[model samples]
Target: MTVMKSVPEAAYGILLRNQCDSALDEAVEQVRNLGYAVLNSGYSDIELQAISDQFDSARERYVDAYGEAKLRSIDEYHSVRSPLTHGGGVFLNLAMNGNLLSVLKKLIPGKFILNQQNCVINPPQENYNQGAWHRDLPYQHFVSTQPIAINALFCVDDFTSENGATFVLPASHKAEAFPSAAYVRKNAVQLEAEAGSFLLLDCMLFHAGGFNRSQSVRRAVNHVYNIPYFKQQINIPNNMQGADLSPEMKEILGFDYMEPASIADYLLTREAKKY
Candidate 1:
């Protein structure tokens, strides 16, 4: 089996420099080399606080609809799916973040679609396991000539080793075959980052969340983006119906680039003059 080479530790220093277009390019190179990169201070403290507040409000609503016990049984912890529907304003801002988008464009050159927006809350508990090791795009073994999917995990709470920080197998994105269970256990490294940091990852990378052994909960918002040809995990356009949105937001949500397939579609395209 072929194994991908890992990036050197020194390359991560590029992310610590001043914010500029060159720095963003360096960060993207780090992602290509290591399968992931951590951007410290990607969001402001105030922005992070707003995200946490929105998460708390959404959690309450989820609990009211689905009992806490039911939620716990579904997964190791609580997670809000398609959070943009509930946390639209704040998450929309995050999706369109200038710096973040710049880095993403490097990975996926042309127009891309927002596939998913999920918020995960890992509460403290003894022997708590987040989930089995898995990929966001599971069961696919072939490597794409270009990136097919990518993830931006925004930390809402400082991720510590004790609080279920994510564990990743460096350079695994380029591997053509999956590693053995023992091999994975032996090589996976814990990723610790502060609140307001962004953990950008190639979706095919092997990773899993660490067990939360702290006194408080760990929170994060996960954004998964993909090539335009693939359908979004959620119908973002339908979800935002009747809501006001900017042209760029509509484009990212896939309103502007719907491919015309049938004669009816061509007629609609002509009527709207989208092409």
Candidate 2:
């Protein structure tokens, strides 16, 4: 093994001084280097309460529609998949929050799409689908030059050790392969954050939900935003048709990139983009 030594006089003061100038800069830097960052969702207490209530109702609605047995067959029992389909304007607003979007704009560059949004409820003392270590992209083992996707998990309840907050392997996004079992055991970190905070993660990060030891369920809404080339978990534009949507909202929700019905339809869109 080669021994390593540091240079005694290397300069790092200017790098430290210029590192992060604002909250946004800090958040971006943390997510880039550490693979995750916690940010205030910027929703007021009343709004947070509203989101919690809405998520509860939406989860119930989904459970009723799908039935527990069917959902369990797919390993998604208590989770609400695509709550936005029934969550009304409140969910829409959360998806379009300016604070979250500003961070996304810096991280994603030109454009990104809402790939999926779901409400995940970690029942006290029970298993959830998210317990396994996996990337938000799933089944992929490559690192992008830049982030291809991001996960903004909005905490609907306080995430705590007692309640089983998320566990993350720091800097795992920068690795092309999963670390050794011993390394994971030594390095896995559980993040605790208050309600109404967004746990921002690079989609490539290796992470999992911890087992809830508290007496109450812990809930969060997870939104995965990805580059437009990736297919969405649900066809958002189709599901959201007839709902009043701004041009910008429509574009972000992927209205602009839907597959065309025919060659003629494809040509029409291609021609329209020319101007």
Among these predictions, the greatest lDDT belongs to 2
Go through the candidates in order and give each one's C-alpha lDDT.
0.80, 0.91
* Candidate 1 overall lDDT versus native: 0.80
How far off is residue 15 in model 2, in Å? Answer: 6.4
- Residue 114 alpha-carbon offset, candidate 1, angstroms: 0.5
TM-score for predicted model 2 compared with the true structure: 0.93
lDDT of candidate 2 over 1-275, digit per residue (tens): 99899768556546444367778878988898889999887899999999988988888888888899999998888688788877767888989988899899888878899999988989999988788899998889999878889999999999999998999999999999989999999999999999999999999999999999999999999999998999889999999999999999999999998999999999999999999
Q: Model 1 residue 209 lDDT?
A: 87
lDDT of 1 by residue, 1-275 (tens): 99999966464435465333576777788788788888764666787788788888877886777777887797624777777776658878877778788888888878788888888877778444445677788888877767788889888889899898999998899997889889887889899998888888998888888889888989888888888877777778878877688887888887766666799988888888753
| Strongest candidate by TM-score | 2
> Can you give the TM-score per candidate against the true fold?
0.84, 0.93
lDDT, candidate 2, at 111? 89
Question: Model 1: clashing residue pairs?
Answer: none
Q: Which ten residues in a row have the lowest lDDT in candidate 2?
A: 9-18
- True-structure Cα RMSD, model 1: 6.3
Off by over 4 Å in 2: 1-19
Clashes of 1: 0
